[model samples]
Target: MVLAELGFDAGQILAGLKPWVECESPTYDAAAVDRMMDLATYDLVAAGATIERIPGRMGFGGSVRATFPHKSAGEPGILISGHLDTVHPVGTLDVLPWRIDGNKCFGPGVMDMKAGNYLAIEAVRKLALAGHETPLPVTVLFTPDEEVGTPSTRELIEMEARKNKYVLVPEPASADGGAVTGRYAIARFHLKAKGKPSHASWALEDGRSAIAAMARKILQIEALTTPDCTFSVGVVKGGQWVNCVSSLCEAEVLSMAKRQADLDDGVERMLALSEEAGGVVFEVTQSVTRPVWEPSSETLAMYDLARDVAKEIGFDLTHGSAGGGSDGNFTGAMGIPTLDSIGVRGHGLHTLDEHIYIDSLVERAQLMAGMLMRLA
Candidate 1:
């Protein structure tokens, strides 16, 4: 389906994008995140969206929701999700200046999400400029602290997702620029072990070492993995010094399972192991950060819409499943038709080399605008 050509001012959009990149809104820095939210609020309002700011817990950045109300049919809106926070801390912006070289723009949070946020803004702007009234209302949910598991905004995301027919997530496209159709479910857990401390040289046999117990548990968890299910112990902390027996140790484990049942099974096994270890008191706390984005008829239809939009723009788009998780995972788990990886393609997300293709700024914006026009 051919929608009206988007009236995109690429230069102006880029001009708005630069300052956003310069604002270093890290996850834990509430003040910096508030500044980024203010910029987004201003831009969205200028583009005719009604903005709402949701305060987050202390020490964490808050979230913003912008609604572009459609005057046509007044149906349940489409939800566009993106994060405004980066993985970097407050001082990162000074160290990592935003720079452009050839076709790529590099800086903190560029590829990971800030670029995606800009694309969403530009899409809404183009639609407004083109005078395409959506049949359904459209809402853009921009959250800070997604990099830290979205604890504060998870309920908000779920509530908005349930009210919408479709959810579009602007996470950066895969390395090949294909859309991600599915993502694995993630359950993050922290395992803490407590034991009696003693002098290592004299009473080693009399005392129980939590660190030794943790090492054994780590190896056991690693052996429980397969191709479909994966587990990793990312962070470990314990031991006061080399001379004394450790009394406490904690390890953070990330578990990925294809299905919820698999996740349950994995957790059960872990709990069993924790119980089996002698002389060690174990505590396990699990959080379901993102559920798996399984394939469904609704998801396929969403992909069809994206493919149609891509074809209209003289490009063919492909879809793939991924192991990484996003808020899209939550929407997909809710049984909504969710299309992810709808943003610019680049490299080094969550790393110092993060960058976005400069050309994708225009192309992906057009694609998003076209899809919204047709779908709405």
Candidate 2:
């Protein structure tokens, strides 16, 4: 019945999602992200939620923590968590314009989670309009920096999860149409090299090649990849002048593992590497680290409950482990019950082609509404 209700008024949901998708709240843009926050506050207020604006003094973007009181209280509450920031930079909308083509609705941050965030708001709005009351309290936290590894809101997410019974994260649904239960532990490093510089024509023998060292180190790092652990080199920069040997070079490495032991070992081995290539030295700095989210008994039980919910709506339910980390990773890693990828189905995340299924706009909201009612 709720599903039908959502489907009937899908246009309203799109009205709410349009501004959010077009705002282009890239993680590094504080003013733009705050504008996005203001827009979210408008929706939460309309849904009868008490809004708390956590200022982005961290120089990123402010976070919104909205509370919807329950008619009857028993547990702490449900922590509905997500991030508003997208990987797309400013002016991306110019290239990746939002449009609707059949079942597909194309936009910048639609599927990666702008649409998912609004699904919760629509759910609550529907419940309110229908005179439905929640069985337990609900807190929605939309932070500003998930695309950039949640640098500003990591502790806030952890602390907020401590107050809730379970964390439901609406990132994107898995490629196989399953919710994500497990997420790989992730780490990032910036490796730099320093070497002697000399003229290309006159002092070739006296010069040291930092670029050569970076290339050699990259080869060694690639060897660290395995079935359990993986490493990726994302960016490379070197050489100030063409005629002189490069004195400095830098590269970024992204590593992931399913288990902490493997992560520890891999990170240790990667950091331990300090080999010389063409008489240059390499140094590595750990920039970001998010622990793996291994499923707990309570989490598995929640998944079972979700499966039942999906079945009741005539859809098959499934789940899988994810390679990317989310805010759920921080909570689930702490042994808290967390459900991820409970959002709309679409593709091309972090790219210009990011989008959500037009039909899922209503379906997911209805499903989440059912979840809130049943789980509570």
Candidate 3:
């Protein structure tokens, strides 16, 4: 029934996702991101959502929270949370414009989240248009900085999640078409080293290379990695010239663990590596920390509902954990029942080939609407 409602609206759904993809809301580009927010706000307002705009001050595009009126007022509502940022840069669409050929629709940001974000609107819009108002309230959250680990939107996501009965994150479907049931704990560290600079050819003996110390630290830190928990160096910068021994070096380290104790232990071990360098300035400090989101009976129960919904829509559904993090992490950490990856079926996320299965558009929308009806 839900699919038949949305079957005629497939083109409309793709049309909705195109504007957001073309807006090119990279997290670093504040103005571009704001455009995406504006577009979403306009659509939500037209859908009868009461809009609350939160200005982003930490050099971000800010956030938008829209609340749709519920039929009854006895229970907490639902929060559908996602972000507008993409890993692709501004000119990505110039090369990989949105197009549908066979089963695929290719474009940047379409798979990672823009498609998912727009699909939520389509879900609620379908319900409203069908004259099916939910007794349980509904809310949607669009943030600007989720692609870069949600630095600006964590608190807002948590605040909204704590007040809601459930959080549904519209990320992409898993590689095997499963929903994300849990996510690893994530933490970031910045390492820096400083030493005297000298000409490599003329004063080689007088120079103490920060690069050398950094290399040692990188190797030692990487050796501590395991299958479940691991440390990775994402960014590194240090030398001035090929002929000179550089005086400064810095690196961004990312660590993930299944448990809090393991994450804490990993940080302590990495910090101990700073003592390896006596002559140079070796320092390790943590920058951001997102606690682990493990599955609970509550989340598992939500997945059971999702699984039944997917089956009704003619698909087999599975659930698992992801190494990466999402806004769901904030809500799940607060012990709110959370479910993720209910977007269109697609893969190659965060890449130029990012796309969604064209046929899954209606199916996912119907599934979302069905879940809303059943839960409400």
Candidate 4:
């Protein structure tokens, strides 16, 4: 509990976080992500951590690993995961000011999750300054492409996750200020349809319209969803002009299923519908970004540890699930004891009005520091 007594400089942390919000590290912008990675390395090093940048497989944006190695070896290391990418395009930070109105601070990537990244660094700094030796080695992993899908860093995350006993993901706390205990599994698919184009007014009957075929498939896909399992056609791009028949159409479908069986069934139904549209050529690209985090004995134990730490610091903590996914999903899928959403609480992620609670910067930092100390 003494770890909770170590006061962190809230001003300094916020100052660091504000400038970070200015960095436009969107999913596809590799150069911007690389810059953000450098910033993360610089911040962690200033916090007394030994930092290294692990090169990604295909020369994409790499992940940064900062370690506070214990004096003894063979201790299970704790892997703390967060991402550097936001969904915003370049120059969004200037458009969204880092202004505080009452208790809330509004800015781009403020809550989801530039603030989380800063909190993780400050927690380690507080523990180091307090001379608190952890029971395990602490390693913080910041990936660059999590906002899109962790295609670049998945292998590295999985590799480091297996080396650790526990994985703590600081992916912005829930809207109600609760920590995340579980997350729904996401199966995303991009469906493309191809057909013959013809004149809209003349010879329309001779043309096999791809857009029409896609509409039928969409209806069938919508019917396959249930309460426990949901599906949506989030993106659709096709067609050329009003006077011509649409020869191509594409849609991006996102499926949130409780179990793999449901996911498989949904996929099967979608593929079958594509096959049924005989006139159109269909292609589906599937991506399982995050596996569902179901409550288990190990996860419950981790939650108990967090709750005990929260009580020691006079903070009330609760656990729940979210529809979103994080690096925690990868570790949870590997059966590691993982706890997520331990960062500052805020709202409007992936939007223009995203912000973090001003007070949460210090409070969540204290909470994470306490959890690290207890877990250590």
In terms of TM-score, the best-performing candidate is 3
The candidate that achieves the highest lDDT relative to the unseen native structure: 2
The CA lDDT of each predicted structure is: 0.83, 0.86, 0.85, 0.81
Query: Tens digit of lDDT per residue, candidate 3, span 1-376?
Result: 5556544377888888787788888999998999999999998987788999999978989899998877664358788998988888899988888888788988889898988888888888878877888757889999999877888888888888888898898898888888988888888889998978999999988888998889988998888998767999988999979899888999989999988889888888877866535579899988778888999999999999999988888998899988788888778888999998888899788877888998888887877787777664
Off by over 4 Å in 3: 1-3, 6-8, 73-75, 276-278
Q: Give the TM-score of candidate 1.
A: 0.90
* Runs off by more than 4 Å, candidate 4: 57-60, 199-206, 240-244, 276-278
The best-first sequence of candidates by TM-score reads 3, 2, 4, 1
Candidate achieving higher lDDT, 1 or 4: 1
Q: Please, what are the lDDT tens digits per residue for candidate 1 over residues 1-376?
A: 2443675655676688889988888888889999999999999998898888898774677888888766643357789999898888766767677888898888888888888889888888877777767667789999887876787888899898998888989999988888988888788888998988999998888788999988988998889898767889988999988888999999898888878778778877766765635788887778656777787897888888899888877778899888768898888888888899989889988878888888777778877887676665
Q: Write the per-residue lDDT of candidate 4 for residues 1-376, one digit (tens) a residue.
A: 4654788766878788877877778867778888888888898998888878887555457789888757854457788999988888778867777787887888877788889888898888878878887778898999888876687788889998988989999989887888887887888788888988999898888788889888887887788789877889988988988878889999998888777677677777666655535577877778655777787788889899998888876778899878877888788878988999999988888887788778777788888887787774
Error of 4 at 88 (Å): 1.5
Candidate 2 lDDT by residue in tens digits, 1-376 = 4456544366787777888898888888999999999999999999898999998966898999998867644358889998998888899999998888888888888888998899988888888787777777889999998887887889999999998888899888888778999899999888999999999778988899888888888998998899889999988999989999888999999899989899998899888986565578789888879998989989998899988888877687699788888988899999989999888888899888888888776667767888787775
Off by over 4 Å in 1: 1-11, 72-74, 198-207, 240-244, 276-278
Global Cα RMSD, each model: 2.6, 2.1, 2.0, 2.2
Number of the candidate with higher lDDT, 2 or 3: 2
Q: Which prediction has more favorable TM-score, 2 or 4?
A: 2
Candidate number that wins on TM-score, 3 or 4:
3
